[model samples]
Target: MVLTNVEEQMSLRLAVEDFLFEESALLDDGRFREWLDLVTEDVRYVIPVQTTRERAHGSAGSTTMAHWDDDYIGLEMRILRLDTEYAWAEDPPSRLRHFVSNVRVRPGSEPDEYEVRSNVMVSRGRGDSRATDLLTAERQDVLRRTDQGFRLARRTVVLDHVVIATHNLAFFF
Candidate 1:
């Protein structure tokens, strides 16, 4: 049976939400290798540094300055580092919880691609620490349809705070 336009849109939204939720779960579970599989070979994952600017200025984030600018290879390398003893940041491993909300999905320039926007809040608690750090951001993503499912092609995370208060940014968003 053929679905109506509204039904199709609803179905697509649910699929996108499911994909994002799964990704979050993987990160929360420290399953970096499995998360990597959800991304495309040419994936570009970036987190631009947010700046406090006047209303006259166009964007708050700098195109050049980024907390993270990674391709598939870079991401793979980072994940590999986590496995080694040299990864001091994650020696004890941080407990992470990702809260994703306000997901919006739309068609992309490519037929098999979709543009998705969402808000994310990550809570991190390190070993023997009572303090839990909270990081909030807006994420813009390009998901490409593949035989397996939707794969992340591109992602840009814009942080809410201009000055980050977290101890370290060793976790993913």
Candidate 2:
């Protein structure tokens, strides 16, 4: 059966949502290597540092320094390190729940690509700790359709808080 443009778009949206859900599940499950596979070889994962200034200062985020600026190779190394026993920050490993919502997907300028924006809240519980660290942010992603499936080509995370409350970033956003 032939699908209309609207129908096709709806299907695409559903596909994108499913892709995000799967990615989140992988991270929450501590499947870092598998999660890295979802990213393209030339993927760029960036988390810009946020600042607070008067209204006259204009934008709050700065390009000078990024909390995280990783290419595929860098990301792969990080994932590999996290999986090793030497990684003290996650040696015991923390329980993480990634909540992704407000997902909005639009066709990108590039062919077979989509620009997606979503709100993410990561709740992490350390071993025997009564407290849970909550990190909130908005992520802008570029997803490209590949032979395997949709792969993340770029991700820009904009954290909500000016001063991050978490002691350390042991979990993915």
Candidate 3:
């Protein structure tokens, strides 16, 4: 059966949402290795530093400083560190729950690519702690269509809070 333009768009949107949900699940389940497969070899993942500024000024996120600005190699190194016994920060491993919402998908500048914007709220709980730290952010991503599926090409995470309350950022977003 042939599909109309709208139908095709709807299908693509659903696929993007599914991809994001699956990625979140992988992170929540602490399956970093599996998650790595979802990104392209030259993927650029960044989380810019957020600050409070006056209304007259520009955006709150700074262009210079970043909490995380990593390429595929850097990401792989982080995952490798997590796998070792010496990575004391994540020795116990935090329980995580990633909630993705408000997904908007549109055509990217490049062919076979989609620009996706979404809101994410991550709940993280550490050892013997009933209290859960919440991290909320808006993510802009570029997903490229491939034979396997849609793979993350680029991602820029803008956090809601200027001051992070969490002990450590050992988990992926």
Candidate 4:
């Protein structure tokens, strides 16, 4: 017999939760390359800028979207750049720990896709700078149960913190 809506949602939620745990584990362990491999080649991974004026209107503006946003090639280039002799972001590198919880899955219009919402707490120590960045957001993902496995077709991370505490936009959430 086939699965019902609740069952399907449960399964998808577990898949995504697994993905999140693995991804966070990789990041925490400093296995960036392994984490990078999880993302789709043509992934639409972006965190748009939010404004205060958008309070009455909304949160984001399309114009503030990253000028040189990443595709697979761009992500790869970033990896290569960081793997070089002179990478400012990672001369010594920072220690990071990501805490994720309260994962909620909302089934989407498409059968293979769902809306995932989660709370995040990212702690990092770079040189003398110590900070525990907190970003509560909902991740809208279009997941596909592909031949390879469940892969994200699209993911938009809508962060609750309009003014970010994180120093760089280098990590994938």
- lDDT leader: 1
> What's the C-alpha lDDT at position 131 in model 1?
93
Q: Which ten residues in a row have the lowest lDDT in candidate 2?
A: 1-10
Candidate 2's C-alpha runs over 4 A off are: 1-4
The residue ranges of model 3 lying beyond 4 angstroms of the native Cα positions read 1-4
lDDT of 1 by residue, 22-72 (tens): 999999999999999999999999999999889898889988899999999
Query: Which tens-of-lDDT digit does each residue in 99-154 have in candidate 2?
Result: 99999888887887889999999999888989998899999999999999999999
**Alpha-carbon TM-score of each model against the true structure:** 0.97, 0.94, 0.96, 0.80
Q: On lDDT, who's better, 1 or 4?
A: 1
Rank candidates, lDDT, best first: 1, 3, 2, 4
TM-score of 4: 0.80
Better of 1 and 4 by TM-score: 1
Model 4 per-residue lDDT tens digits across residues 1-173: 23477877687778889987887898887787886777777677665665556467764635566523567777778777777886777667767788888988766666765656677777676777554555556666665556666666666676766677767766566
- Where does candidate 4 have its weakest 10-residue lDDT segment? 59-68
The TM-score ranking, best first, is: 1, 3, 2, 4
| Candidate 3: worst-modelled 10 consecutive residues by lDDT | 1-10
Clashing pairs in 3: none
